[model samples]
Target: MTLQEIFALSPIMLAFGVHAQLSKTTQNSTSNVKEEDVEVIRIVESRIQRLSSGATGLGLDSYETPQSVSIVEDDTIANYQLDDINSLFEHVTGINIDRTETDRTYFNSRGFDITSMHVDGSGVPFGDIFVGDMDTAIYERVEFIRGSNGLITGLGNPSGTVNYVRKRPENDFAARVDLTYGRWAKMRAVADVSTPLTESGTWAARAVVVHQDKESWLNLYGNNRNVVYGVVDGQISDTVTVTVGYSFHDNNAEGNTWGAVPQIYSDGTQADFPASTTTAMNWTYWDTLNRNAFAEVSWFINDDLNFTSKLNHINYEEQSELFYTYWNTGLDRQTGLGLLGYPGKFSAKDDTLIWDNTLQGNFNTWGREHTFIVGVSLADAQTSDLDSAAMSGFDVMPAFAGWTGNEVSRPEWAAPTEAGFADIKLNRYYTAMQLSVSDRLDLVLGGSFIDYDNEGEAWGASTSTTEDGTSPYLGFTWEAIDNVNFYASYSDIYQPQYYLNEDIEPLGSAYGRSYEAGVKSRFENNFLISLALFRTEQENLYEFLGYDDGDGVDDEDYSDDFTYALYQGITVASNGFEVEVSGPLNDEWSLIGGLTVLNMRGENGSEARTHIPRRTFKLLADYAPQWNEKLNAGVSVRWQSEVYSETTGFGRITQDSYGLVGGYASYTFNQQLSLHVNVDNILDETYLGSVRSEQTFAGSPTDYSVTLRWDF
Candidate 1:
């Protein structure tokens, strides 16, 4: 059917009874009351089943057989008012979000970081903010599999996996548009449209675009993001389905306001300033880009037999331009500080391409039940960095001109003319599999092998690195009873830290391992509760205190030649327990909250980072009074616990780790339009969503926004 034909059949428009009203006035001789057909108003929400092609008992699960797994459905996505990819992560049962660096959000599961991300169970080349890329609008749901997805993810950190389930086309026409404006000129607009091209619903297509920009609450910094995406799905005969998709995202961040915590008073009191001051030093502009394209084909050999193939192509780039201004703890009449290090610039770029595929399925066997999945994959990940010396110098705390809010800082020195260059490449091939004995029992076994080559000129010297090794995996899961489940798994994982050494070549390592158990209750999919216990360990931890390269001359020149200072790195082991409950409390109220307590020991418990929070809590509550259905409003609040930062015995990065709350109210005017207003950090509390922990930066406050949406 054509678009116009579909529009004519819309139930929403028929409910107005306008056509019948005109007909009655023109030709009804029955002022005496005539029999008439009554139009029924019916609304059909998007079907949960139509959201994905298949299901594995729980919601949409990772078909590749995971050590332990879970899914976050689309309905959940809409429930939380999540606007971006990072926002949706809170839905994960055991995951925690941390801001370890500026704009670099770190998500951890089972005591380790999550470095792998997928698109419909396949890799998206550039997964996180590291590449300043991600546009979550095209996917229907996301599946997170903790522990060694190496069978499908190839080489990288094996701690956990994030798979963005891309949405395909159907015969029905669906479209939604949203526009929002936030504090400091933060504005965003997004549009999505999808439909089928063939009468039989054999061919379908979808397109999406998103644009957003916002001013920094930290003073001079501001950020902007743009995305464009498209996809095509075709049914090749009745047994095979083919899908191809492409996504592009560009992110530019200026006036980096890395946060800094004060050192005075132990209770933690935030001193107010002009807001533009970087605390001590925060002056840099960093930009990044990520582009991805992928193709997938699924074939059903019989009612119970199926095979799937996937190919992903990705391109990522990063750019940086910074000016450093030193802060001397000065009082502000102007920019508040003086210049120290010379104004300099540092830039790096990464290019990666991954080729992977999986052959997996389930076969009837055993008196009980059995399911198995296996796959093989490969990747070519490369990086290059270009740097420069001091170019200009200005007052670190210049005379004020209305603090732009962007942090400005200078570098202490520059790389020797020929040194500061890096070019490296790593190639890897991995094979893995998972087998489950029962609906509630699963076992995971996998392996990975990597070979890498790197060559670069950094610090006025040439260097090269060659390395190869294998990582193994093992895991098991069992449901203890009706409302409780327990799972324990282990996997040895690694990553290439590749970077320019004194010689300038890629040299890196990897780390990850976990023993986990969890209990989940899902009497109603809308109301989910879970508690997880995990023991995590990390290895290959490499930290360089920096060794002097022999460059002739005296002690000063003695620092020329890079000598050697290497210890396999510190090993950290952590035991933690987490509890969470989210979803509807009733028809008018819903909640999302969780808490985690961890006991971490690094370098065999010799020392603790003073500032890292050992315990953290996150809570969100939403209430919507029906008010007769047509009109409804919702209010939501969010909060977190005290967090820690490093201490130098002089000053510290303090994140008292307090609570933050935000509220949002939305109203539906009709079937096609809605308006929403949100005040994030309604208390306007001065706090950090995350911390980087240094004299350089910390995080800033809550902001507000309003959004309007139209759907058909």
Candidate 2:
């Protein structure tokens, strides 16, 4: 079906039971519509399991929260083979994944970059340039909140927040193993086991191990990854519990590109490169390692009160030998002689520590029962980097035409230098209350106070800053009907800037506010539907003014290193809407999908972030046949509107609208064994992987994989 038709018919089908098959699930068996039957259907409770805390830290389900939220469950992840963060987010509503290079990726939502991230309600330090490819084997599910989350995150942009929920040990004994083989000589193995460690079943432990080695469809590209995780859960008393865990991940990649292919030729014509094209040499490699340790304690003060505390520590290291190729004079269509090569060796290390504590309880107020939550969090992080450049000679490649990856000899590197260093600290105090004003109306009020400090040297300059601010949050939900709710919310955004002015002083922070309103409805059999409209306004965002001259400013003495580009603040606004639906249609079929529309403009009313698509749609559907009893199948579709980017001297480069299709199927021979198959890019659609900059990469082509599973 077309995008327009799908959007038009979704609400009608959901509200009035227009579809013949859906009617059976939406209404009772009786043909006649009675008032009592309508009321019975409206009050039907949800049977779906709920998370401890998701969008608001209130332990509320999607229909109860006053914001836009989406979830990717474990079943969906396994069926689609979403092994990595990039593949997992592609299925989320209103999320766009930009693969700028082989090993680097960026995400965008609501016309802004998504920078806020958490693991089990605790914030983590993350950036596109620093974090490596994240594996999802250790996670049970991923929760998404599609708007400003400053109330809980302390300080951040108005984009969105992502939280990953880890898999924990269960009281019962269970074990599973999987072996997979796929195209391009890919091989993978995974083992997971969980069991009760004590006779009383009050203590449990779980362990998981994974290993994968895969060759890319791109020439001269491959990688190997390994992961290990272990966790222990113990109940010290009837009202107290404790948990501890540790995880390690290592990945090594060869022939990874630093950037992507050039977009334009010397003649101002667009360049066309095959999906299998690569600009990396055989000797170049990128390797990364990560370790995490965490501990948690939960105490139930009484039936009406509870408290929880958590601590986490993380260490990360990276080493790489990379070669970057760019066209200084633009590429010539006939000769391809303008390529310039920059080879470098680099290493970096980072350490982070985080602590969070929360208290939640119920109280009787105004003849009604209300809920409140208060929390505090602390985060400390430090990082250092070393960089080495190639010798003065050997800066230009011989030719690009008919060139092989082994053509260039490894260049000699100079002495390593301290390229960057940073130390950051943050402390946050926050509280929120859910007031049960009446039987149908509920109000939520909360805010956060943050103290932040940073000291670092980067981008050939020195930096030091200290700032503090308060961000407030307000919202309300009205149960207009038994199973339907209307809600609205307001949130503040505060983000500090690291850029410096001509005077070598750090620029201040950017401030903003976000407003959102939506309607949510729950149906029988755990189906849910939501529609939201949102707007955000931000000011004091840094805007590059030009580089300063060598002369001193106002006749004052200044060093050469301080002559960097100056910047000023600017304002921008973003407005958007989203429609999402999820849950099972009946016993045989289930589906999840969404549609997003956005518009972003600068103060002058011109388009901002034009490279991001304004409209996108994603959907996934699964089916299980009753006759077969052991057969299952699924399909997925993703479509995006046209997007374009403007280069300094090359004008505009555009990527037209495109769509991709994928499918999967599985069969069980018995309770202990099963076979599964998956296919990506089923129609072999060719498109650009990323178009947010002048350098662009081609998307993946058709691929397939098969797996065998055993359960005990």
Candidate 3:
């Protein structure tokens, strides 16, 4: 019912529905849409619409792009009410999300999970363990450019790239505020505001702030976070535009409680860790702080030329560790005894500087079409930290409710803080340029060259320096059917060098290549759909393990000394197909969905390195019914196929896969205010988002959150 209709009835009746159940109700009915598939018109933001006066292939020569690409539009964000990195990412095809205690965010795309993030064509830094540590408030649209960016961003994985575009100042002032409450005591508040700084509308400023806290399915694990972001844009003249932005975020966690402990008992029978065992080991909680700033400018040289440049800086500091990792101290797998696992105090800091510049040109020949783009990129980052630890030879384990920041006294260990920390520093740079040609006939040709270098030093037994090279990209796109676009692209990627291990041996550099094909289409601005097939090969892979340096010292010394180094550049490859559909099917209803299937394997089970995964899948869907202009309700579901990775010592480990479902209904009584509630993980699906065999740590559990939002 419309808000007005419900209001006219009885306030008591509306109150009763407000307290109704928030559960997912499946729809088994088949789609009534015509059998003949129709292309979905894209309702994407202006930045990604690819405007062109002629039949010239959209602004950028995507047909000639060396790698794969995906775009998440503004409509997607507004419809899903995405106010964070995870929600924005969930809508992108091939992307996966795993929330660890609500403190950290982990994701996997293609086949690699520990991805390097980038924003506005610049590389963004990640936490020590390779988790994204950036605020999403400063972003308006997200562009995913797959493949090697040797010609664009310089250094990145061949799997793909994620580029976040900060929200730009419009010609007028605008703002949005949202409040939400969901199951599990979840409460969230967010505000985004922008306005012109001058009557001429040449200067503009915008800001976004968010604060949220919630519990998890796990016993003692949960999350709390606060983020602030601001940006300013100035038009120097009719031909010039400049932009500056910054963001600060703090992620405070209750526990790092890695995944569940292995299923084992005193007699070897699979037994659960007591449904109440939430805290993994003794980790109480940890906190991390991150900040970033950047400046960008664009110049319109002439009728057919434009130049753009951006410089970015990022910093991160970790105060405490969520949990102390415990591994099998003995190589013998039979004991199953966890060694040295508990909560450890730690501190770390990281700083990064990245820059990117691009030039775009438009020209005409023989009444045909030609668009060109040339760009270069570079980045440097370093991180290090120290920590203290204490272990009880054999102590009684504690339950989730009983776990706290209090430390345990050990008779054998005094001033356990004596366990120092590892100090590390690293630096790297990448440069690339590309030129493309396109014909109105739906054909494009392009070529690019890339150069990269890496050098770094680390204390605590390791220091090294290295460099590498890469050159490979071929692509093609053809309109097979009336509105169907078929595309194929190949690219080669490379990375800078880093330390090998505790010995400081240099692993030199790493490189790889990718092959992909897909077909995509846009509907009448309501939604979009696409399908892709891909495969990738990586060389010069890095390997880590416990090595006996032939010294009388025990494995403890070796484990501490052994780090990682390049062996022979193991040949690792992955192939898969992905399908994505998003947009409203009708006036009253809208939907979004995707699916992925991966097949990746190593050659001859090479010990040097192992293939990422044999097969995996990711799916997402959302349906919202307008139910009259003043009232709306909808549900969203995201799912990922199981994951499997092999270990040099352990044969194969399987990561269970699962799905997460959420629903929301909102009512706006007036133009200035509204109330809404959402239910996440409606089914409470159980699954692991990540796993570290060596550390014996898994991701957090499935839970729900209830939120209340408001705007003026």
Candidate 4:
């Protein structure tokens, strides 16, 4: 049914702001409502509600939107003891993680790469190999939306988008602390405190601090980190609200690997490395530092009308010193010889600023209630990098068979020389309207106009590129039953290309279109189920061709170094289906599960995209017995199909399918204290975690941890 009619069925839960508070006492003090019953309702609502800012400009339920959305809230994160954003994505639905390196990772959806990210609804830029080193303690929840989000994020792939919602100051005083210990000497501590600054509880502040230190499965590789965050929230007046926050993170680590272990051996057979094996040297190091400051302001004109704006500034830097090896030179299958090494030091920095403004409200047209939203956003990002040689006496290690992790010494690097710099700016304006067509149907129409510009230095020369276009979106939703809704949507996206061809001509821009249809249903107001089918077509996709240089170097032009002239485009089509079920099925049990299947091909009907799986499944469940209120247990399973990639010397390497099983148990000592134990990879399965163009990374073995949480 229409949005207005659906809310009318449950005003106590769907109403907003001052209007909803008036009847809070009446609902809580009802004659039939008991304390335990109220607690169950609160738990269910906190875990299953569809209130989010990512699905639409205004908070909309899953049945009201035409896209796929999944959220990982604070309760789930704490229960699972997820340390960071990277760990959370591993359990999300319809998404695949490609951990090419220990610290760097990439996400793929529907055979396409996801490059769009937002913090508190403001856009953030992304790079190829940069790690988004964020601590999860400062976030309220992480939201993932599938399919094209061009209506809000401007130019990007038609894959998906991610948004991080920060924790806000509460009106009451609260404090919490957690201590955790795990294998590999891993130890972590976190503290969170929120308190009101005014007697009326209109002004408040919150602070979160975390410290973590851990040793890795790989030899000589470990991590040490420190994070601090603080936020202030104020109800300046009855109509105004404001929030400001700042966060800082620093990470130090040793034995950072530049690439994966060698996959090809001397006898032409694929080499298998032990889980604890590593090519990283004891003296190698990589460190990162990130700082962010943000502010948000909102004005509530009425229950149905509101205006919001946000500003964010981010600064990030990374420094590294290392020595790496490659088999680009043909390997000697008989002697395990013929490898080349390079020793270098590098540093990079990125600075960004983002601004966003939005206005949303409800209005009546032709005696029907409708919702409308208008927004404008701008982002500017600048990056610079430099590289230099290592210490004078430290030359590239020449002997691969006689080297060990203990033979390396710390490097004293020389001053770096300026390599390049870039400046990118993006501007976008968009509007959307949700119209109630009939008692059983709703229509959504929106479009975004984008202007993009880039200026940088390439190959020792100054360069600039500019492009602009409009992305259009349309969707329709029909109520098929009391709680089941069917929806269909179509969206288009455009992005500019900055590469030059062999003839020194700039290539054409990239374009893509997505079509999706889905059905969603909610049972008992506590459980949710959805199934979706989607098809996407992309053109002008770029790839670099290996242009053999006379020196036997595969893709390099040794003379002028590898240039963009070798990159060209090809057409691709991808189709996929996804299914998900999540939330509580009853008062004593909860569950979450998902499955995905994909088919992607090129112009010649050949399988496209290497190092990515074609199918994936995940499940997590928890149960608390009614006979015992102090004990709870959980279990999880994850599986992925086979994947393969071609090598220059070995021809082709395939990784067989594998599955991992884990479980958790918790004992509640009282209302304010609890202890939990968790285990992962219980079977200790040995499998390839990720495959790169020339190498493969191995997965971790069995591990366990214990956590104690105190809330006051």
Shift in Å, residue 6, candidate 3: 62
Over the stretch 465-500, how does candidate 2's per-residue lDDT look in tens digits?
A: 899998888999999989899999998888877766
Model 2 residue-pair collision total: 0
TM-score list, all predictions = 0.76, 0.89, 0.77, 0.89
Query: In lDDT terms, how accurate is model 1?
Result: 0.53
lDDT of 2 at 126: 38
Q: Residue-wise lDDT of candidate 3 within 151-177, one digit each (tens)? A: 443444655566666676655678887
Q: Identify the superior model by TM-score, candidate 1 or candidate 3.
A: 3
Q: Is candidate 1 or candidate 2 better by TM-score?
A: 2
624-705: candidate 1 lDDT, tens digit per residue: 7776665444444444456555433324445665655656677888999988877655676665445433333433466677
* Pairs in clash, predicted candidate 4: 266-333
Q: Which ten residues in a row have the lowest lDDT in candidate 1?
A: 37-46
For each candidate, the alpha-carbon lDDT, in order, equals 0.53, 0.77, 0.51, 0.72
* lDDT tens digits, residue span 268-316, model 4: 5776767776667777788999899777666656546677777677888
